[model samples]
Target: MPKILKILQEDHRHHDILLSILENQVKDAHLTGEPDYDIVSAIVDYFLTYPAEFHHAREDKIYEKIVARDASAAEEIGHLDEEHEACEAFIKAFAAALSNVLGAGIITRSQFANAALEFIESQRRHIRMEESIFFPTALRVLTTEDWASLDAELSDTADPIFGSQKEGQFEALRQEIMDWQSTREPANDHVPGDHKLRL
Candidate 1:
């Protein structure tokens, strides 16, 4: 596989881990009467800000090229642009519903669960679509020259939650990811180094 597709799959794994944390919190909130609003807020903020705003935008840029190079591939995926928008919307709604906990129009835990579940399902589906279909196709079809152009266009949108430079706000999420990562085998477990085009 070309390095970019590998990097994308690694990104998907990170996203999956984060989503699992969010789901666990949602389950706890459902069982207990108290929700970890802070953790939930951090997660929602991270998703809306980083993955939705930055990652999806980067993918859309590559997707543009994918469509240009292979029209049939584009036809299969349809409008992933819309899927990105939908994820952000779902997260916003989830956050709003969580925020409702502190007010008169409090959403029940079940309602919050539904919203959270929807977001998780959507994200997993999107990732699976990319991993199973898009990544393989792009690796097979997208040229090194194509990746070079995309890499040139790619901005330095380093992840705030999982990047080298750890920012202040995402500390909890970072810890959660790190703690989860630690449990897994440490052999060759590095997040894919950012790809610098060599060809």
Candidate 2:
């Protein structure tokens, strides 16, 4: 596998961890009739920090390169790009809703719970499309030279949003989220009318 693909696969593992956290929070919220603020905040932080900055940066750069090389891929790449934009927008909205709940204390716990659930659903679908369709297509279509160029580009492209030294910060943030998840009790509680915990 190319270095970029390897990074992306590793990222998928992290995304799985995050999805688990989100599912757990949703389950706990429904069963306990309490919002898991820590998990919620952690998700928001991850979206704002890692996903938005690092992962998306890599995806955008690689996809842009692919499109540049193969004009026939323009349509597919465009659709994928739009999906990326949609995911970013949803994350921002979800994060804003979370902030409103925390800062203004206006939204009910139930409302916050719904928001989290919706965010989770959106993420699940987005992940499926990327992992199943977009990534596989890229892997099949991109040549060894293309992959090499992407790797080189990724190394050179500094994430301004994450500062110049982003890799270290990204790893640190990932560890922080993992440590938090490890310390928390498994969310097995069931809320009325809500499905069983899937985490």
Candidate 3:
């Protein structure tokens, strides 16, 4: 229940919500033959605003410090860092693919679907690793002083993506994400015969 862990956990909650929204959108796209650009844009915005900016910043500056300070975690921390880099690469590639489709409409819907699925799958695994392994390791390794410093750093860091209105912008983003989640029914709710979870 350290402050740093609390903040990171909150950030993970947002990530989960966003992932759910993306999953819902993908399901809708598959069923209705409709591309939900709004949802796609929202996911991209989250990468730009939260994951790429806030989450990466905290992990690199704060969490990395804890990992570096702990000699016992050196190998595990190195692996985690590589995974983080891979996740970032996937995000960038997904964003580029989305932008290409949106801009030129050259990529077919199936192609977009495939790309999005890859992104989602990679992200899902990455999140699981972080939540199950990385976060727990961080909690065990970092001391009170480390946690306090992380909290302070997080508080002081201003989101360049949102400028001076970061809080207001985040509030609006949160509401939009919540609204989408509320309105969309799960694909499984209306599945035809003998539907099973694929992955």
Candidate 4:
């Protein structure tokens, strides 16, 4: 596996954990009637910034090269860039909904819950598609030279949450990830029913 792919997979792992945390928080909010807006905001803020700024761009670089190397691979790749755009839109819309919830505006708990679950499920599905379809296609078709070119061309941007220089701004969210990781039993990459909420 190329280093870039490994990094992307690691990013997906971190994202899965965060999504689980978000799911747990959303469930709690549904039950308690009081949402932990700060934590929720932190998770939303992290998604809004990190994945767009660093993660997807890296994947796009690789995906572009794969298509150039083999046009047939394009079918497997299949609108991933558009999906990235959609993911960004998801985060932005979720952030706006979160703002409304925080302000105690017209957004109902049902609306907020729907937005949160949509973002979480969309993200999980995207990652799964990339891992299943995209990454394997890249590995099969891309030559050693291709990997070398991609490795040289790609920038080494440290992830804000999981990277070595972890940002202090994400301290609360980071702790939530850690606590969530510690408590959960080992499970498959695809967490079935994890996103289900009581509404």
Candidate 5:
């Protein structure tokens, strides 16, 4: 497996764990009638910034090469292109829903709940599809030359949350990640309905 693909898979693992956490928090909010705004905001911030800024861009960059190698691979990855856009839309909606729930705007509890659940479901489905379908196809088709080209074209960026630097914007997200990591069980192996991802 290439390093770039490994990194992408690792990023997906992180996203799965975070999405699980967010899903649980959303459920909790329904029961308590008070949403964990900080956590919700943190998730929104993380998705809005990290994945949008880096993860998807990285994937898209390599995907361009993948298509260049095998044009049919383009058909397989087509949904993901739409999914990337859908994800952005969901993030925006989730953020706005949170704002309404937090009293900065006007959103009903049911609306917020619906948005969170929808976001969680869509994200999970996207990850599962990528893992089950998109990745293996790329691994099978892409060559050493393709990987080398990708590696040279894309420079490494330090992760603010999982890496050395801690940015102020991700303060809440950092705490949530730390808290989840400390207590998170081992074994990222996916069994049916098991959402924990090995850090």
Candidate 6:
């Protein structure tokens, strides 16, 4: 895999963690009568801004090169641009629903749960599709020279939540992720030097 693909996959992993956190909050709402709106807002805000601005843009650039180089790959890749747009739309809808719940308490628990889970599942499916089909096709079709050209064209955009420079607004979410990871790690397992928490 190209370095870019590795970065994208890492971003997907970070997103999965966020989705897990969101899911937990939704579940906890059943007992508490309300979710943590601040956490929900932070997660939604990150989704609304990050992927559209950085992650998907990079994928679109690479996909464009793939289709240009091998027209046959287009059939295999399907319409990724449309998928990205749909993902963004889902995020926006989810954000709006969250806003409605926060501002007016108009949305019922069931309705909010449905919207949140749909957003999470849809994002997971899109990531799976890209990893299983689009990414593999790129590796099979795109040349080293193509990757080099793409590397030159793409910006090394930092992930505000997971990157080296942590954004202040995301501090709580970052700590949540770290806490979540700690529970999953073995008692004696060594933390990787490059782990996000360490950074």
> Best candidate, lDDT-wise?
6
Whose TM-score is greatest here? 4
Candidate 5 wrong stretches, greater than 4 Å? 182-199
Q: Runs in model 2 with CA error above 4 Å?
A: 156-199
lDDT of 5 by residue, 1-199 (tens): 7777777777787787778678878888768977677877888888888888888888887777778888898687775677789988888888888877777687787888899888888788778878887888788788888887777766567555554565787677767776776786765543233444232
What is the total number of backbone clashes in candidate 1? 0
How high is each candidate's TM-score? 0.84, 0.74, 0.76, 0.92, 0.87, 0.91
What is the TM-score ranking, best to worst?
4, 6, 5, 1, 3, 2
Off by over 4 Å in 1: 1-3, 180-199
Task: Enumerate residue pairs that collide in model 1.
Answer: none
Q: Taking the tens digit of each residue's C-alpha lDDT, what string does model 3 give over 1-199?
A: 7776665655655565566667777778878987677657767766765676667667767556665788677557556567677877877777787888779757777777777778777877776766777777787887888878877766555432223435543454555565765665555221122221111
lDDT (C-alpha) at residue 46 in model 5: 82
The TM-score of predicted model 1 comes to 0.84
lDDT-wise, the better of 3 and 6 is 6
Q: Which model, 1 or 2, shows the larger lDDT?
A: 1
Local error of candidate 4 at residue 1 (angstroms): 1.6
Model 6 residue 67 CA deviation (Å) reads 0.8
Q: Using alpha carbons, what is the TM-score of model 3?
A: 0.76
lDDT: worst 10-residue window of model 5: 190-199
Q: Show where candidate 6 strays beyond 4 Å.
A: 185-199
Looking at candidate 4, the ten consecutive residues that score lowest on lDDT are: 190-199
lDDT of each: 0.72, 0.66, 0.65, 0.82, 0.76, 0.83
Better by lDDT, candidate 4 or 2: 4
Candidate 5 structure, TM-score to reference: 0.87
Superposed Cα deviation of residue 50, candidate 5 (Å)? 1.2
lDDT of 6 by residue, 32-113 (tens): 9988888889999899989989999999988898889998897778988999999998998898899888887598889999
- Backbone clash numbers for all candidates listed: 0, 0, 0, 0, 0, 0
